[model samples]
Target chain A: MLRIAASGDWTIAHLSAADGELRSLTAGPVKAGRAVIDFSGIARFDTSSAAVLERTARLLEEKGLRVEFEGVSEPQRRLLDKIDTYGTPDTSKAPPAPFYIELVERIGVTTREIGEEARGMLGFIGTVVSAIGRTAANPRRFRLVPFVHHMEKSGFDALPLVCLLTFLIGAVVAQQGAVQLRQFGAEVFTVNLIAIIFLREVGLLLTAIIVAGRSGSAFTAEIGSMKMREEIDAMRALGLDPMEMLVIPRVAALTVTLPLLTFIADLMGLLGGGVVVFFMLDMSPGVYMSRVQEAVDFWTIAVGLIKAPFMAAVIALVGCRAGLSVTGSAESVGAMTTRSVVRSIFLVIILDALFAMFFTAVGI
Target chain B: MAQKGEPIIEVEGLMTRFGDHVIHEDLDLTVNRGEVIGIVGGSGTGKSVLLRTILGLKKPDAGRIRVFGIDLAELPEEERRLHERRWGVLFQDGALFSALTIAENIQVPYREHLHLSQELMDELAAIKIAMVGLRPTAASLYPSELSGGMRKRAGLARALALDPEILFLDEPTAGLDPIGAAAFDDLINELKEALGLTVFLVTHDLDTLHATCDRIAVLAEKHVILVGTIDDMLRSDHPWIHEYFHGPRARAALAGK
Candidate 1:
């Protein structure tokens, strides 16, 4: 048995047997009357290569020589069918026609147009920002009625969940702090741990996250649906600034309501931690209350209060920005609502961390 | 018939692009006072974009959009808002606030722009709701409780709250049953005649187009290819134009004749 291993660059020229030497080499061993073609070494095969193989098979049959084919890859088999269909001398040259070039071009043009639109949107953002700035400058002109409605929705309606989550978080924190403080024979310090953290960070953080998930998502969905319905356009047609009439009121409401909610959450959380301190640490209610009062200073409360407006601003901005970014259909409203919640919570946490750093650096 | 005064809206070379997709390019159109022009087009052909650009909600990339003789692009944000009060737009969805009662929705624009007393605002809201044919009892109900037709009517009432000179309706009769749509068309016609409002209506419903519009502007092939009467459109030799106005679907729709 004659074994033949053939491997080379499977270019069109090589596959086509364009060179007399390569053709003779493929034909010579077969003509000598014993050969097994090993195709495993062949990395690439084209129509021309398949045609050469078919031609060699015919020549071997004519010479009364039995030839065995080996290592025929799937791609090679597919090429063989293509060669047979086209009656392959394989003169077709030039790269296989690009299927996606038109799609790519269309996508490119679309991307450029979208980029321009985004740039224009930047200008609109400036307008929105300035409008917000003006409203901030003239708080009286920004009516309180809409803001009052927003507060009822964002704050009052969200109270049950805020209270529940803060209570649970307070219990968890106090329990965890007691475990560590007891190791240091400072079990009484659990009151300070729970009180200080609850007043300074955890209470405000939990409240903001809840509001971001609840109110922020609500704002995005509401405005996003309005956008989808062209209600925003209708407002514009009626000579109303969507920012002033819609977003400003929402932002203002969140700004005012978040601080109040945070204060509420802080109070509730401290009460919850007092429960844990009283039971787990064997401290009396009066003693826990006195310890918390001594441990948490006004500055700690102020630091948390300061972070509330910032968190509120983040929630409002992310909600409105995501809502404003929505285009096309109802699906986009849902998508942006989710995006608004995620971005608001992320920004709130980041802002909280920064506030923590600032307070710590200033030794406040 | 156009009067000899300046057009109420003059949109010159208006071009709007969303990302790489060009929705409208070099679009020039005019809306005169007291003329109801219907904008008819296939889906995604930018009929809504033109109305939105005119309203200054979607800014045109390269165009001069002037409404009520003021260049919207040149006006400051506050001034643009002042200019906007001159027009009214009824969205297709009748986007009433779900939380507010019908009366409160009508009071929104008024309360935002005016300093009227609560009783006076309530009175004005009642009048507007009555104009839309809703009973006084309907005023206290939220939008979620109202029927589709009633919501559309309430939305119309809210649009008319400012007493705008120009009115725009986006698919006012869409999704409504035949009788409801006809009733809406009748309401639009009555409102148009009573107010002498310059109306720009965007619609796909052929019956609404034939019954209500003074003239129809067909958007095709990335342009407003034709703007004429139904008779003029029927006479045109353009293939798509013919297919649109006199096609099998259209013929079947009008087959009762």
Candidate 2:
């Protein structure tokens, strides 16, 4: 028989020390035989230390020894028994895969998720298209209140920021253009450069990017939180189509507002360019205005206007789809809102590039 | 642990206010070691606020709160933390950190307070998980994945990680089904007896009060109107206390007990 004496404060405060000592005692080179763990010298006892003692006994017992407890008081025995009942917990969760295998698995999962996302987005677009068609077929079915509310929210509320940003970009462009043209003794050409860039590209591009960041994120947060709360589920349960009630109003309002905002951006950009030319080039506002008129025709101005409604529709669709796809959590809502802004901005830039190529091929 | 029947928590002339809304006024109570004390009240009587104040999460406007015979508010920061470590608290909804697994949550207090090997901590976490009646698989699962009842159990396990001498539970049975609630009551009773823990329970469930509480404290008119055993509560002639103990639901709870 092997005798082991357990002593000292066997509580949580001294748990690690006690555990280490007990483990070392069990690890010594003793033949497997009847072992007695005596606790008579123990000054204090608690469940944590009891667990260590029980674990040590079990380890010894598994190695072909009969383990017995001696000198345990009644309360201490009850605690020891309580820890014994729980036993050693099984922590046999699957180990992580090797790095290369995990990489390959992650790549496969990401590819599949992207494919599903594309299919879902296409399906959502189709639903929105049909809902718009239905509303157009019956004008009375259109929700006037929400449409107007969204128009004010996405359009009117976005006006100041869009104008301010486009105006600053226009002024910076004209100032830089004038400096470069002056080196070539053609400072007068700055007005033409400003007119062409603002009317053909910058106005609608800047406005679209701004609205995508502002209104797009708002739409996602509003709808995503509602989705998290099961309000979307409740609406579907009540037989109300979310496409008609939620998506159509927001999309249609953005489509109508983007072109109008682009027009305002174009005017603001010209006014800003005129101010810079007048101040820096010693050109009068009258001369700048006439030069702008001489540089731009209906085609240059229509190039940006034509791309407005398409980008607006894309942004609104991306935002609404992300919102509807939100799972039931605050974290998911935040992630979806961020995805809405990022995706809408990306698609707007891609759409602008496509429109630029189309207009170039058609000799616009 | 202090000797049984020794005062572990003492509150005198306590007042809690939010702006012009007074929650508690001149409230007094003493909690002895090794007792399950339940705090009960009608809606909007500040039961949770009182618990928060006692936990020092909120400062009482006017009062003295002495825990383990030390006035917590007057103690230095380092010493106050030492006193605070003697107790554990379970919030209304098991506020487990969403990012951590249940095992990691249980290990949090241990990691903060003690120096132990990773392997030992993992063993202790598994033991805690089993002690709270959770399946072994629950150790690896996140808080969001667990059901309402399982989350509460996980929260209780985390609270008990340090082997705290006192356990403060807020509405422990509020969202549980009747069967689940009864099981929880039994678990609390068992843990308290085995650990020699003083339990401060804030609950609305009459069945829980009947099954687990050693004493009941009733809150009314922004103060504790009475504190006693169930028999004393039943004998009280105060309108709210009389109606509370004689209500139809109370009758059913009493019959079940």
* Docking class of predicted structure 2: medium
| Candidate 1, residue A16: lDDT | 28
Every model's DockQ, to 2 decimals?
Answer: 0.01, 0.56
Interface RMSD of 1: 38.3
The TM-scores of all predictions, comma-separated, are: 0.46, 0.94
The sequence of per-residue lDDT tens digits that candidate 1 reaches over residues A1-364 is 5565657654333332333444475556444566676777786553334545655555665567676778886656654554344331222224754769878988999999769756865676587689978987987778679889999999999999999889989999989999999899998888888888888889999999999999999999989988988999999999988999888889889999999999999988988888888889788988888887899888989998998998898799778878888885566788889878987898799898888899889999
Q: Write the per-residue lDDT of candidate 2 for residues A1-364, one digit (tens) a residue.
A: 8888988778787788777877787777667789999999898787788888899998888778999999998778888888889988676568889999999999999999989999999999888888989989998989989999999999999999998998999999999999999999999999999999999899998999999999999899988999999999999999998888899999999999999999999999988888899899989988888888899899999998999999999989998989999986788989999999999999999999999899989999
Candidate 1 lDDT, tens digit per residue, B47-151? 988888888788789979888877978988898887787678899889888768888998898778866556445655665676667777777888878888888
Candidate 2 Cα errors over 4 Å, as ranges: A1-6, A21-30, A41-44, A180-183, A237-239
Model 1 reaches what TM-score against the true structure?
0.46
Instruction: List RMSD in Å for every model shown.
Output: 27.0, 2.3
**Interface RMSD, candidate 2?**
1.6
